[model samples]
Target: MYEKYDVVIIGAGAAGMMSAIECGKRGRKTLLIDHAKKIGEKIRISGGGRCNFTNLNTSPIKYISKNPSFIISALNQYNQEDFIDLVKKYKIKYHEKKLGQLFCDNSAQEIIDMLLNECKLANVVLKIDTKVIEVSYKDKIFITRDNSKTYLSSSLIVATGGLSVPKIGASKFGYDLAKQFNLNVIDTVPALVPLTFNEKILNKCKLLAGVSANAIISLKKTLFEEGMLFTHRGLSGPSILQISSYWKEGESLNINLCPEKNIFNFLLDKRNTSPKQNINSIINSFLAKRLANIICEENQIAGNIGGLSNKNIKKLSDSINNWIVEPIGTEGYKTAEVTLGGVNTDELSSKTMMCKKHPGLFFIGEVVDITGHLGGYNFQWAWSSGFVAGQHA
Candidate 1:
């Protein structure tokens, strides 16, 4: 004997919980399930405890996908404003950090508790630590559990997310499920992660570990101007993480350590005016001292600025302004903030997030090929896609 639900949702993360709440609100018997013992582990650790739940400047331009336009409908239907209204309704204290990124003033648990409370109000059933070993569909959806109990449903929603942060239960189950249903799956890669370099570059990073500087990190046309941090292994911080999404192996990145200053011109003017100033001391004014020392050492920039010829000045300037370094690889899924690709966008309807070939089956969130830039755009996608699918699921 099995207790059936009208809608069965897998992975009780952001999307799954939101979808379940909406489905329940619509008078559908919804069951949200997850294998993890603790719910919202990702949310718990997000923004260093205070979750960046949404972004005010969310637009199609901020997201990366094969078909970027696919997210328009869902995002329009349930925009960041709507989610922000909900947060306000819950009276959750929040503030905008920067670039429209909103984080709770207290803990991320406030957001998690809000979703759980909403689920409770909507009569959504939640099952954690319930592993579904298998899923199949033949007119009706069937979920086979590890406990030998099988649950059937009219509609199935897969919100299993992507293979990022494996510690939080991110898996390829969603992608495999899409393939099982004859839907196209995109090749996945780690995104919003730190870039690692060869020993030469790593050694410099190691020396300047804990040092930070405002930088403009660019890969071809794409560029992010933000804070960059030197790590023991390689480069990290917002600017590096943002660029890492677009960077591939063997490609060089043009990093401007001093984005505000025209280095070559600054040096020329400095040489003309302050003839007695040390070149290293001048660079240290704009950049971190440790990093300036490294740059000075690299360029063999010694002693006074007046002693240097134009050639020596240009060499030092180019090294600081156009610091080209190629990353050998990334930190990978273990440290990635999100996954780049998933089920092909063409495989599902953008309006409803439903599989084109399979009726009553849906995919949402990071599993659906719509990876947003760093900040809360990805979470907004989760809320939007899940809300949209919930309407029809």
Candidate 2:
């Protein structure tokens, strides 16, 4: 006989685990399954292993979705404070990093353990390393198959996340499952990933590798003021990664290398006070030594600041203030922190995260079209959406 459950949740990641706990808490027999041997691998490695679990400043505005207002209901229903309360209940020591990002004081495993313990207390059944072979719906019941067993449930929740960080088992299974159910799946792309430059640009900036500076990276109207890092492949840092979500192929990024000060004014002041100082030397005080030299050489400003003509000074200032770079592409899903698109939000109810046409089917987490900015925003989405679904699933 097939094992029966009130709800069957696929993927034991953040969303699935949270959903299972809630469902089980409601006195529903819940079964949470994953193909991986270990659960919460992404959470285990997130935030340099400390896990930026949630953002204090979480709002619907921070998310990107086809339906921009679709996330408002879930977010309002389960805000960051609600999750913070849960963390406090677990006695997980956490600290607030910059920009309202909250990270655990210890390893991310604390988060995984907390979720696992919640599931245990809620009496949620968990199955790891169990590959789902097939799924079918009949007589208002969903039937799912693993390699050696068949399971039946009244409700099915698909928390299988997006196709990012494939090494940790990210897959297109969520998108495929959405299609199988005739739900619209948006075209997916890598987000919160590094941008790669062309050979020409890379060659010019290659010497600046490992250099980091306070920068403002802008794509169209959106701007992110944070630290930008120069890498061998291209640029990767809080600012660049934040902007990458809004960037598209064939678009150029406007980078303000020194957002904290006006380069033109600084250089002009330096020209008066330190006439004999090399132009690059003045720039080096603000930027990295290697990047300063590269920018000076690229703009053909070789002499001291006092010897530079007005035109040369303007050119140098422009190079520093409004540097434009066109990236060839991104590092792709191999290293992307999240996938930008997924099951279309239009097909699911924002309040419950359940499919409009299919009563018992739900989609949550990164599998949904709503993608958050870098930091703890994505985790908040997972919690909000998962909680909403679990309440009704």
Q: Could you give candidate 2's per-residue lDDT for residues 1-393 as a string of tens digits?
A: 699999999999999999999999999999999998899999999999999999999998898988889989998899999999999999999999999999999989999999999999999999999989788899999999999999999999999998898888787888898999999999999999999988877876567778898899998899999999987787889999999899998999999998888888888888899999988778888888898888888887787889988788888888889999998889999989999989999899988999998999999999999999998999999989989999999
Candidate 1 lDDT, 1-393, residue by residue in tens: 777889999999999999998999999999899999998888889888999999999999999999999999998899999999999999999999999999999999999999999999999988998877888876566654546567788899999988989987888888988888888998999999999999999999999999998889998899999999999989999999999889988899999888888888998899899989998899889888888899999887889898988898888888878889999999999999999989999989988888888889999988989999999999999999999999999
Instruction: Report lDDT (CA) for all predictions.
Output: 0.91, 0.91
On lDDT, the candidate that comes out on top is 2
In TM-score terms, which candidate is top?
1
Off by over 4 Å in 1: 141-146
Off by over 4 Å in 2: none
